[model samples]
Every structure is written in C-alpha cells, then in structure tokens.
Target: MYDYLVVGSGLFGAVFAHEAMQAGKTVLVLERRDHVGGNVYCETKDGIHIHKYGAHIFHTSYEDIWNYVNQFVKFNNFINSPVAYYQGHLYNLPFNMNTFRELWDIVTPAQAEAIIAVQRRSITGTPKNLEEQAISLVGTDIYMKLIKGYTEKQWGRSCSELPAFIIKRLPVRYTFDNNYFNDRYQGIPIGGYNKLIEALLAGVEVRTGVDYLKERALYRNVAKTIVYTGSIDEYFDYKLGQLEYRGLHFETERLEEVNHQGVAVVNYTERDVPYTRIIEHKHFESGTQPVTYITREYPAEWKRGEEAYYPVNSEQNQRLYQQYAILGRQEQNVIFGGRLAEYKYYDMDDVIKSALECVHKRL
Candidate 1:
C-alpha cells in the first residue's frame, strides 16, 4: 500500500508527490491526461517546441520558488513582453510611456501626463463596472483602444457586466520599459516543462491515462491519504452543481519558414477577431532554424467533460465554488489543490509557491 495517492500529475500533484516521497513515503501519481505537466505541456515538431495549451512564461519574485524550479532544468532568459493590437494599431503592453507615445504621438512625459489627467477627469466617482474601472485607471483613450474589446471578448461578456473588482488597477508606467511582469525571476525552462515535471517525479511511481475516479475505490483502499488535484466538483460528482470555467481551443500549424510572428505572443485586442491571441513557438526558444510552428488560441465554452482552462471567477461562479469548498473540507483524507481543484486561475509561480507552502504544512 502506498502512503500517498496523488490524483492528476500536474504541477501540484507532481510537486506534492515528490515532497511526500522525500519524506520517506511511497507515492503513486495518477493523471487523467495521457501525458504529464498539465497545461504546461509542450509538443515538439520539426525541432520546434510548441506550447500545446498556451504560451506559459514562468515569472516569480519568490527566490525560494525560483530556486525550487531551477533544481529540475536550466531556464533561459525569456522575459515576457506581450504586444497589444487594436484597430490595426500596435502598442507596447503594460501601459508604458512608449505605449503612450504610440497611442497619442506625444513626445514628452509631461504631455503624456497632461493627456491622462484630462482623460481621468472625464470620469468621476467609484467605478461600478470594469469599463469605468479601466477608464479611471488608464484613461478613456487607452481603455477604449486596448482594454475594452479584449476584455469583453475574453470574458464573453460586456465590460459593464463585469465587476469593477476584476480590474482593481491597470498598471501604467511613465517609463519606456515594456517588460510584462515586474517579477525578479522570469524565464522558460531550457528544454520544456515536461522535462521539468519528469525531473520532479523521477523516483515516484506515475500512471498516466488513468482516471482516478474510475478506479476510486481500488486506489483509495491501497493509499493512506489522497492528494487530489482534479476538479473538486468532479470528485463529489457535481452534487452542489458545476463550477464555471472559460475553455480554449487551439489551432496549431507547422510552417517551413524559420519565423512567423516576430514575438512569442501577440494579443489581438480587436473585438472582431475571433481568437484572443496567436503564439509563435520558436520565438520562446530564441530558435534559429528552417522550420517554425504557431498556434491560434480561440476561446470556447466549458462543458462538463471538456478541459477547463480558466475559472470564470464571477460572483455567481465564486458562490458556487464556495459550496464545493465546503464539501471538500468534509473529505477526511482528501486534499484539493491546483487551479482546477480550487476553481481559481493561477500563474506558474503562484502554483509553485502554493505547492511549496502546502508541502511545508501537510508533509
């Protein structure tokens, strides 16, 4: 009998299993997907490593978390600087001074400040919705051009319908810097996330393409404790109803030319565009070769059996998730974790930090 049974071999499951095993416990990891690494999974074709789910750039300010990830594979200096496109106009993201100049043709910081002041004065009082919140933070021009359409498309709802809390503050920089994340450590694994996961689960027993729910009784009877990283709703058979999530559909292609898009990620902010963004794989690797691959990311509705990418996190969804959490707490030997189990969206760094904290407390 194993000491721990980790369901879902994602980052949470893998990290927890590794930690438990190091504590002299026998661990068995079961993943519903055929492969490991969860959403961070990458596929290679013609010497190009493509981010199968989406472009995942690892960035963290936590030194311990950074050091923990480095134990598996060397990371490259791949800082994320995503560009925003709106109405055939391109601008540097994160609302930097360069983006301001590109938007208004203003040369001096004083002029940029004056323009934003006027825009901010036009809107007054606490923002009731996302539209007003964005306007208050970044001004009307930037909001209308960059934030409005893109956010609307992403959430599949109007900005007015979305809560103002969703966008508490829009990051605006007076400097010319356009580095997306302000974190101290940021990069992609030298090989791929799959390799990193493999290193983490080196000594642990792993079985992929095995649904834990199907063999629930058999696995549970053998293990002393269950570390589940699958959806909490699924674990309880959706007894409290389903938690909502926004799904994504990817259309990937391999091309003969060395490059497609100049950058790793390009955001299509225009509302008319069906997909949110397109990712060029080789750019993430800084690869120089004769072939390249790209993937178009389209948003989709999350159904019961489909892969749920991002939790909706609306008022209603959060309320429903609270019910699931209550039921989860009652599960004596089961621990819910990761983005899916908790019904929340998490960046790579956040997940790593969470797993580290969980290991410290649980193990």
Candidate 2:
C-alpha cells in the first residue's frame, strides 16, 4: 500500500507528497482536472503563458517561505501593481498618494489625509455593513470609485448587504508607491506555475483526470493514509449542508497587436460593467510577442458541482464548516489541507507553508 494518497495535485498536496517521497515513503497523487497544477495551471498560447484560472501573483513576507519555493524553480521580479478603471479614469491601486493625486489633484500626503479625513466624517459611530466600513477606512470617494463596484461584482452581492467585518481594514498608503502587496517578496514563477508544480511532483507518481471521490472504492484501500485536498463538506458527503463560494468566469481572447492593456491586471470598477477585471497574460511575464492574450474575468454565484473560487466566510457558512470540521476530525486516516479542504482563502505562499507544516507534523 502507498504511504499517502494525495487527492489533489495543488500546491499543498504536491508539497506534502514531495516531502513524503523525500523521506522515503510511497506517495500517489490524484488530480480531478485533466492537468496536475490545479487552479494554478497555465495554458500557453503562442509563447505566452495564460493564467487559465486568473492572475495569481505570489507575495509573502516570510523569508523561509520565499527560500523554500525558490528550491524548485526560478522566479522573476514581477511586482504586482494593479490599476483600477472607474468612470473613464485610471487610478493606482491600494489607495496611495498617486491615486489621491489623480482623484483630487493633491500632491502631498497631508493634503490626501485631510481630504480622506473629511470624507470619512460622513460615517460616525459603529459601522453596520461593508459600505460604511470601507468609507470609514478610506473615505467615500475611494470606496465609491475603487472599492464598491469591484467588491460588489466580486461577491455577487451589494456592498450594503455584506457584513462590515468583510472590509475590516482598507490600507491607505501615503507614498506614491503603487505596489499592491505589502509583502517583501513578490513575483510569479519564471516559466509559469506549472514548472513549480512539475518540479514538486518530479519523483512522485501522479494520475491526472482522476476523480477520487467518484472512484473511491478502487483507490481507498490502496493507500495507508489519505491526504484529501478537496472540499471538506464534500468529504463528509455534505451531510452538514454545503458551504457557499464566489465563482469566476474567464473569457480569453487573442489579439494581433501586442500589449492590449498597459499592465498585467486592470480592475474595471464600474457597476454597469459585468466583468470585474481584465488580465493581460503577456504582461505577467513582460512578453514581447507579436500578439497578446487577455482574459476578462467575471464573478458569478457558485453553485453545487461548479468550481468553487473564493469561500463565502459568512457566519452561517462558518457554522456549517465547523460542523464538517468535527466530522473531519473523526476520519480514520484522512488528513484535510489546502484552501478547499479547509474552507478558507489561501495565497500561494500560505498554502505552500501549510503543506510544509503538514509534512513536518504528520509525516
């Protein structure tokens, strides 16, 4: 019997399986998708690596995590500076001094702070919903133009209806810097995430296009321990109600000219606009190809059997997940990890760190 049967070929499972193999254990990885990289999988077209799912920028403040990922594949210095388009105006992301200057024709940090403070006065006492919370943090102008429409489209719900804690803190930078993440280390894999995944799964056996849940009987007895990275609720057969998630629909188009959009990511923060953002795949790698590929991302309501993107961390869903967590603890030899299995959103670095910890603790 294999020592571990990794049920997903995502980062978590790949790392765990790799470590297990390094420690001289037999591990088998199974991926439901046709490819092994999970959502990080890229479909290359005309020398441009298209982020099939969406734009995934890896950023982390941990030094060890940065060093650990670098072991597999080389990463390029691609900083994420996403731009937001609102009402025919372009603004730098993260509500920085540049954004303030563009919005209110202000140059100094003091001017920006003064304007934001005055606008924030519109909300007083305890904020009830996401709208008030955002306004209280970054003022009405930034919230209205940059935050409101994009957030609404992302969650598929009006900001007013969402919980206040959803936007507990909106970082307002005083510098002209447009770097989106505050993390020290940030970049994408030089050749795309597939290289990283392939390197991780190098010495391990993997089976693609294999649904473990459906063919449980054939593989259940093959491994001594099961490392499940699928949805936790689904593991228990959803006996304790299904959790909610926001889904994304991507439409990728190839154009003849190079550089369709100036940057890698552009947020279309207009309520009337159906899509949330447009990603220029070529810009992710600074490709100088004769043609460019862009993907327009549209957020949608996630239903059962559909790909779950971001988990809805509402109180009701958290309660349901807790019930499933209890059942998960009782599983004989199954270990749950990764975003889907844990019912939480995880960045690439966080997920890799989690998998390493899982290996150290469990293996």
Candidate 3:
C-alpha cells in the first residue's frame, strides 16, 4: 500500500507528493485530466510555448516560495504589464500617471487626484453596489471605461447588480509604473510549467485520465492517507449543496506573423466586445519564433461538467461551502487542499505556499 494517495496532480498535489516522497513515503498521484501540469499546462508550437488553459504569470512576494519554484527550472524576468483597450483608446494599466495622461492629459498626481476627487463626489451616500463602490474609489471615467465592462463580463452581471465589497480597493498608482503585480519575484518557468511538475513528481507514480471519485472507496484502501484536491462538495457527493464558480472559454489562433500583439495580455474594456482579453503566448517568454499564437478569453457561466476557473465567492455560495467544509473536516485520514477544496481564488505562489504549509502541519 502507498503511504499517500494524492488526488488531482495539480500544483498542490504535486507539491504534497514531492514532500511525502522526500520523507521516504510512497505517493500515487491521480490526475483527472490527461496532462500532469494541470491548468498551468503549456503546448509548444513552432518553438513558441502557448499557455493552453490561460496566461499564468508566477508572481509572489514570498522569497521561500520563489526559491522553491526556481529549484526546478530557471525563470526569466517577465513583469506583467498588461495594457487595456477601451473604445479604440489604449491606456497603461494599474491606473498610473501614464493612464491619467492618456485619459485626461494630467501629468502631475495632484491634477489627476483633483479630477478623480471631483468625480468621486457624485456618490451621494454609502456605496450601494459595485458600480457605486468603484466610482467612489476611482471616479466615473475609469469606472465606465476600465472597470465596468470587464467586471460585468467576468461575473455575468452588471456592476450595479454585483456586490459592493467586490470593488473594495481598486489598485491605483501615482507612479508611471505599468507593472501589474507588486511582487518581488515574477516570471514563467524557462520551458513551461510542465518542467516544474515533472521535476516535482520525478519519483512519484502518476496516473492521468483517472477519476478517483468513480472508485474512491477502492482507491482509499490502496494508500494509508488520502490527500484530495478536488471539489470538496463533490467529495461528499454534494450532500449540502453545489457551490458556484465563474468559468472561461478560450479560442486560440495560430497567426502566420512573428508577433500578434506586442504585449502578452491586453484587456478589452468595452461592453460591445464579448471577450475579456487577448493573450499572445510567445510574449510571455520573449520568444522570437517565426509564428505566434493568441487566445481570446470569453467569460462564461460555469456548471458541473465544465471546468471551473474562478470561484463565485457570493454570500450564498460561501455559506454553502461552509456547510461542506464541516463535512470535509470529519473525513478520517483525508485532507482537502487547493483552490477547489477551499473555494478561494489562489495565485500560483499562494497555492505553492499552501501546499508547503499543509505538508509541514499534516505530514
């Protein structure tokens, strides 16, 4: 019998299996998908690595987590400076001086602040919904041109109908910095995320295209402890209720030219446009290949069969997840970890940190 039976060979499962193996434990990693790397999987085309699922930029302030990933593959300096396109106008992201200059020709911070301050005064009382919350934080222009369309498309609802707490803090920068994340370390692995997953599960036995839930009882006896990284609600057969999530559908294209969009990511902040953003894959690694690949991300309503990308952290969903969490905790010798289990939107670094912490505490 194996020491641990790890379900879902994503980053979390890979890390836990790696740790368990390092401590002289046998691990059997079962992935429901066909590949090993999970959502971070990349497909190589014409020497250019294409982010198959979506663009995943590794960024984190935690030094240990940064160092942990670096041991597998070398990372190049790739700062995520995604641009936003609204009504045929291009603006620098993160609401910086460059964006202000493009928006209203305001060079200094005071001038930009004055414009925002004047616009913010339009809010009469406490913010009622996401629309009011956003206008109260960053004024009307940015809200209409930048935030509204994208937010609406993502959650499949208008900003006026969404929760006010969603726009609690829109990251605005006084500096001209276009770098999206404020992390110390940010970049993709040299070849692809597959390299990192391969290195992590070097000795661990992995079976892809295997659905553990189909024969969970049989799999449970194959190992001493079970580390489940799938949906917690599904683990208990959705006894309480089904949690909600926001999904995405990608349409990728192979362009004949060397580069499609100069930048890696571009946000289309227009309500008329159906897709949220377009990601040029080669730009992530600065590849100079002859051909390029681009993917258009269309936000969609999530269901059980479709892949759940982001959790819908609505009050009702959170309440339902809490009921499931209590049931999950009662499972003997079973551990629930990762985004699906916790129902949280986790960055790459956060998932790695969580997996490491789980190993330390449980193992």
Candidate 4:
C-alpha cells in the first residue's frame, strides 16, 4: 500500500506528495482533469503559454515561499500593471497617483487627495453596501468609472445589492506606482507553470482523468492516508448544502499579429462590456513569437457539476462550510487542504506554504 493517496494533482497535492516522497514515503496522485497544475495550467500555442484558467501572476512577500518555488522552476520578472478601459479613456489600476492624474488631470498627490476628499463627502456614517463602501474608500469618480462596473459584472449583482465588506478597502496609492501587489517577489514561471508541476511530480506516480470521488472504494484502502484538495461540500456528498462559487469562462483567440492590446492585461470596466478583462498571453512571458494569443474572461454564475473558481464567502456559505469542517475533522486518515477544500481563496504562494506545512506535520 502507498503511504499517501493524494486525491488531486494540483499545487497542494503535488507539494505534499513531493515532500512525503523526500521523507521516504510512497505517494500516488490522482487528477480529475486531463492535465495537472489545477488552475495554474497553461496551454501552449506558437511558443506562448496561454493561461488556461485565467491570468495567475504569482506574487508573495514570504521569502521562503518564493525560494521554495524557484527550486522547482525559474520565474520571470513580470510585474502586474493591468490597465483599466472605461468608455474611451484608459487609466492605471490600483487607484494610484497615475490613475488620479489620468482621471482629474492632476499631477500632485495633494491635489488628488483633495479631489477624492471632496467626492467622498457625499457619503457619511457607516457605508451600507459595496457602492457606498467603495465611494467611501476611493471617492465617487473612481468608484463609478473603475470599481462599479467591473465589480458588478464580476459578482453578477449590483454594487448596491452586495455587502459593504465585499470591498473592505480599495488600494489607494499616493505614488505613481502601477504595481498591483506590494509583495517582495512577483512573477510568472519562466517556462510556464507546467514546468513547476512536472518538477514537483517528477518521480511520483500520477494518474490523470481519474475521479477519486467516484472510485472512492477502489482507492480508499489503497493507502494509509488521503490528501484531499477538492471541494469540501462535494466530498461529503453535499449532505449539508451546496457552497456557492463565482465561476469564470475564458474565450481565448490566437491572433496573427505580434501584439494586440500592447500589455498583458486590460480590464474593460464598462458594464456594457460583458467580459471583465482581456489577457494577452505573450506579454506574460515577453515572447518573441510571430503570433500572439488573447483571452476574454467573463465572470459566470456557478452551478453544480460545473468548474468552480472563486468561492463565494457569503454568510450562509461560510456557515455551511463550518458544518463540512466539522465532518472533515471527524473523518480519520483524511486531510483536506487548498482553496476548495477549505472553502477559502488562497494565493499561489500561500497554497504552497500550506502544503509544506501539512507535510511537516505529517512527516
């Protein structure tokens, strides 16, 4: 029997399996999808790594996490500076000085702050919903132009209908910086995320297109322990209730030109525009290929039996997840990790860190 039966070949499973193997443990990884890497999976077209799920720019402040990933695959110096397209005007993201300058034609930070202060006076007391919360944070102009449409389209609900906590804080910068994250390290894998996944699962046995949930009886007794990285609710057969999730639909196109939008990512902030952002894949790697590829990403409402993306952290879903957590804690020889398993959103580096911690505890 194997020492560990990893139920998913994603980052968490791969890392755990790799670490367990290093500690002299036998591991078998099973993936439901035809390929591994989970959401970080990339499809290659003309030497350009097309993000199969969405634009996943790995950014982290932890030095150890950064170093751990670099051991498997080298990373590029790609920084996320996504531009926002509203009506006919384009502005920098993260509501920085460059964005304020583009909006009110003011170069100084004081002038920008003054403008935001004046606009923010429209809201008083505690903000009720997402609209008021956003306006309170970044003022009316930025909220209306940048935040409102993009956010409404993302959740498929009006900002006024959403909770105020949905947008706890809008990133407001006094500098002319457009770097989205404040992390010490940020980049994409030099040869795409597949290289990292391959390196992690190098000598470990892995089987793709195997639904462990369906064939639970076949593998349940095959190993001494199981590392589950899929949905927590689904693992219990949804006996409690279904956890809500916001799905994403990607429509990728291969263009004959060298460049399309002149940048890696551009957010279309008009409510009239259906898609949230268009990602130019080549720019993520600074490819010198003859052809380019782009993808229009649309936020979708998730249903059962569909691919789940972001977990909806609504009040009800959280309560239901707690019930599943209780059940998970009672299950022996089973350990849950990663986004879906925890019913929480996790960055790439955070997930890797979690996997390492899990292995440390196990081994």
Candidate 5:
C-alpha cells in the first residue's frame, strides 16, 4: 500500500504528491482525464501550443509560490494586459490613464482625477449594488462601456441584483499601466504547464484515465491515506446539496496566417457579443509560424455532471459549501482541495499557494 493516493492530477494533486514524495513518502497520482496537468494541459497542433482549457496566465504576489513553480519550468515574459472591447471601442484594462484617454480623451492624470472625483461625489450614500459601485468609482462612461454589460453577462444577473461587495473597489490608476494583475511576477512557462507538471512528478507513479471514484474501494484499500482533489460534495454523494459554479465552453480553431489577434486575449465587454473573450494561442508563445490557433470562450451554466469552473459564491451556495466543508472535516483520511474540491474559484497562483499550505499542514 502506498503512503498517499492522490486523486486528480491538477496543480493541487501534483504539488502535494511531489512534496509528499520529497518527504520520503510513497505516493500514487490518479487522473480522471487521459492526460496529466489537469485543466492547465496544452497540446501542439500545426506548430501551435493550444491551451486546451482556458488561457492560464501565471501571476502571483507570493514569492514562495513563485519560486516553487519556477523549479519545474522556465517561464517566459508574458505579461497579461487584456484589452476590453465594448461596442467597437477598445480600452486598456485595469482602468488606467490609457483607458481614460481612450474613453474620454483625457490626456493628463489631473483631468482623470477631477472626473473621477466629481463622479464619486455625485453618488451620495453607500453603494448597494454593482451598478452603484461602478458609478461611484469610475463614473458613467467607463462603467457603461467597460464593466456594465460584461459583468452582467459574466454572472448572468443584472447589476442591481449583484451585491456591491462583489466589486469592493474598481482600481483606477493615474499612471499609464495596463497590466491586469498587480503581481510582482507574471508569465507563462516556456515549454507549457504540462511539461512543468511532468517535471514536478518525475519520479511519482501517475496513472492517467484512472477515475478514483470508479475504483474508490480498491484504491482506498491500497493507500494509507487519501489526498482527494475532486468535488467534496461528490465525495459524500451530494448528501449536502451540490454547490454551483459558472462553467465555460471553449471553441478553438486554427488559421492559415501566422497572426490572428495582436494580443493574446481580447475581451468583448458588450452585451451583444455571445462569447466573453477570444484567445489567440500563438501570441502566448511569441510564435512565428504560418498557422496559428484561436479559441472563443463562452460562459455557460454549470450542471451536476459537468466540470465546474468559477464557483457561484452566492449566499445560498456559500451555506451549502459550508455544510460540505463540515463533512470534509469529519473525514480524517480524506483531503479535499483545488477549486472543484473546495467549491471555490481560485487563480493559478492562489492554487499553488493553497497546495503549499495544504502540504505544510498535512505533512
């Protein structure tokens, strides 16, 4: 029997397995999918490395997590500066001077500051909803063009329905910076995340196309402890109601030309657009090939059987997750983790930091 049976070969599983092995423990990693690296998996087609899942840009403020991931793969300097397109008008994201200039032709920081100050002063009381929050922070023009429709479509709810707390603050910068994440380090791995996972679990025994739940009894009997990174609610057969998540559907295609879009990601913030964003795969790699690939990302409602993406952390869902969490605590041998397991939406950096913390506490 192995010391640990790590289920799901995502970042959480892979990192924990690697660390456990390093601590002189025998670990077995089982992945439900045919491939490893979980959602961060990439494949080369027509000389283009396509992100099979979504575009995962690694950005983290935590230095320990940054240094830890750097051990496996060399990262490229791919700063994520996503462009927002609303009704044929493009603006640099993160509400910077460039965005303000594009939005209102305000050239100076003082002009932008005066505009925002007036807008903030116009809103009298405390903001109650997302619409009020946006108006209070960045004014009507930027809110309407950039945030309103996109956010409404993202959550599939009216701005009035969404709580103001959802957007605590809309970061408005006086400078001309457009980098989305306020992280010290940000980039994609040189070879891709798949290679990084492969390097991380070099010596560990990994079996792809192996569903832990399907072989639950046998696997549990074979391992001394279980490190599960699947849905915690599923582990208990949804005794507590299943937590909700907003799923995404990606439609990918390869083109004959070397370039598709100038940038890696271009978000369509208008309500008219069905898809949220278009990702040009080659831009991530700085590729100079005859053919390039692109993907259209469409947000969808998460079903029971489908893969969960963004957690629907509404009041009801939070309560449901808490109930499942209570059940998780009772299981001494099982370790529930990752976005799916915990029923929480986490960026790549957050997942790494979380995995590190999990490993530290468990072993």
Candidate 6:
C-alpha cells in the first residue's frame, strides 16, 4: 500500500510526490497523458525543444521556490521578450518605450506619456466593460492594434462582451526594456522540462495512460492519502455542474530553413490573422539546429473531455468552483491542487509553491 497516490504527473503532483518520497513515504503517481511534465512538457526534434502546450517562461520572485526548482535542473538565461505583430508591423511588448517610439516616433518618455495621457481621456469616470477599462488604461490606439483581436481570440468573446474586472491590470511601462516578466528570476530549464519532471519523480513510482477517476476505487484503496491534480468538478463527476474553460489548438510545423521569425514568440494581434500567436520553438533556447519548428496557437472553445487549458473565470464558474471546493474540503482522504483541480490559472512557479505548501500541510 502506498502512502500517497498522486493523480497527475503535472508540476503540482510531481512536487508533492517528490516531497513525500523524500520523507520516506511510498508514492504512486498516475498520469492520463503518455508522458509527464504536464503542460510544460516539451518534445525534442532535430535538437530543438518544442513547447508542446505553449511558450512557458518560468518567472518568479519567490526566492525559496526558485531555489527549489534549480535543485532538479539547471535553468538557462532565456528571458521572455514576446514581440507583437500587427498589420505587417512588429512592436515591442509590455507597452514599453521602444513600442512607443515605433508607434509614434517618440525618442523621449515625455512624448509617449503626453500621447498616452491624451488618449486615455477618451473614457471618463468608471469604466463599464472590458472595452472601456482597456481604453481608460492604454487608450484606443494600443487597444485596437495590440489588445482587442488577440484578447478576442483568447477568450472567444469581444472585449465589449467581457467583464471589466477581467482585465484589471494591463501593465504599461515607460522603459526601453522589452522583458515581459517583471520577476527577478526567469528562464527555461536547461535541457527541457522533461528532465525536471524526471528528477522530481526520481525513486517515485509513476503510471501513465491511467485516469484515476476511471479506477478511483482500486487506487483509492491502495493509498492512504490521495493527491488529486485533475479537475475538481470531474473528481465529483460534475455532480453540481461543469466548469467552463478556454482551450487552444496548436498547429506545429517544421521549416526547411535554419531560422524562422527570428524570435521565440510573436503575437499576431490582428483579427485577420485567425490565430493569436506563432511560436518559433528553436528560439526558446537559441538552438543552432539545421531546421526550425514553429507552432501557431489557435484559441478555441473548451468542452468536456477536451483538455481544458485556461479556466473561464466567469461569476457562475467561480460559484460552482466554490461549491466544489467545499466538497473537496470535506473529502478527508483527498487533496485537490494545481490549475485544473482548483479551476484557476497558475504560473509554473506558483504551482510548485502551492504543491510544496500542500506537502507541508499534509505531511
């Protein structure tokens, strides 16, 4: 009999299982996917590491969490500097000064500030919806070219239709820096995320191609404590109601040329583009491979049994999740963690931190 049965080989379950193993507890990790590492999983081809899910740049200000990950694998100095492509023009991201110069030929910060201030006055008083909220923050110019279509593609709804609180903070910087994340620690794993997962699951038993809910009784009987990293609503068989999510379909291709698009991530911010962004996989690690691989990320609607990517944090979904959370708390033998289980979005570092906290609380 195992002390802990981890439901998914994702970061949350992997970290908790690793901690449990360190404490000399027997752990069995079950994953529905063929391979591990969850969303951060990468497949290598011709010496290029392609981000299977999407471009994930690990960035965190948490010192202990940063140190904890570095123990498993070495991290590279790859900073996320995603460029936005709009109507045959590319602009630096994060609403920085470089973007301002490209957009309005402004060398000084004052010119950018003056232009933004005048544009922000387009909306007055309290913003009504996502459209007004965005305009009130960055004005109509940036909203049209950078925000509108991209966001529409992501959420499958227009900014006008979405709630204003959805886009509470749109970071606008007046600097020449193009670095997307403001975190002190940021990079990708040296080899790939698979190595990190392998290290984390060292000496721990893992079974892939197995869905816990399908054979919950069998697995639950084998372990004393259950670490569920799958969907919380699904764990309860969607008894109350099904939670909503936004899914993504990736169109990956291998280019004949050595380099394609020059950068790792390029956001297609135009409505005509169809897809939201195109990622050049080789650029993530500056690979000098003979061929290049790129993935065009197309946002789609999420349905049941389809891998839910981003949870749709609508008011109804939140209330439903709260009900599930209450049910989860009452399940004395089970633990619900990670993005999917919690019905919330989490960065890679945040997931690790939460997993560690769970391990501490349980053990």
Q: Candidate 3, 119: how far from true, in Å?
A: 1.0
Question: What lDDT is obtained when candidate 3 is compared to the true structure?
Answer: 0.91
| lDDT values for all models | 0.88, 0.93, 0.91, 0.93, 0.87, 0.92
How many steric overlaps are in each model, in order? Answer: 0, 0, 0, 0, 0, 0
Structural similarity to truth (TM-score) of each candidate: 0.97, 0.99, 0.98, 0.99, 0.96, 0.98
Candidate 5 lDDT over residue span 138-166, tens digit each: 88888888888888878888888988877
* lDDT, candidate 2, 247-311, per-residue tens: 99999999998878899999999999999999999888889999999999999998878898889
Q: What is the lDDT of residue 189 in candidate 2?
A: 94
- Model 3 residue runs over 4 Å out of place are none
Give me the displacement of residue 293 in model 1, in angstroms. Answer: 0.7
Number of the candidate with higher TM-score, 1 or 4: 4
Best candidate (score: lDDT): 4
Deviation in Å, model 6, residue 162 alpha carbon: 0.7
lDDT of 1 by residue, 316-354 (tens): 989999999988898888888999999988888888778
Off by over 4 Å in 2: none
lDDT for model 2: 0.93
- Enumerate residue pairs that collide in model 1: none
TM-score of 1: 0.97
Model 4 off-target regions past 4 Å?
none
Q: Which 10-residue window in model 5 sums to the lowest lDDT?
A: 115-124
- Candidate 3 residue lDDT tens string, 1-363: 998999998899999999999989899999999998889988988888888889999999999998999998999899999999998889989899999999998789999999999999999799999999999999999999999998999999988998888767989998899999999999989998889999999988999999999887678799888999988888888888888888999999999989777999999999889999999999989999898899999999988877888888678898899989888888898989999988988998999999999988876
Show the lowest summed lDDT stretch of 10 residues, model 4.
Answer: 310-319
For model 4, how does the per-residue alpha-carbon lDDT over 1-363 read when each residue is reduced to its tens digit? 999999988889999999999999999999999999899999998999999999999999999999999999999999999999999899998789999889998989999999999999999999999999999988999999998999999999999998898789878999989999999999999989999999999999999999999999898999999999999999999999899999999999989998898899999999999999999999999998989999999999999888899888677788899999999999999999999999988998899999999999989
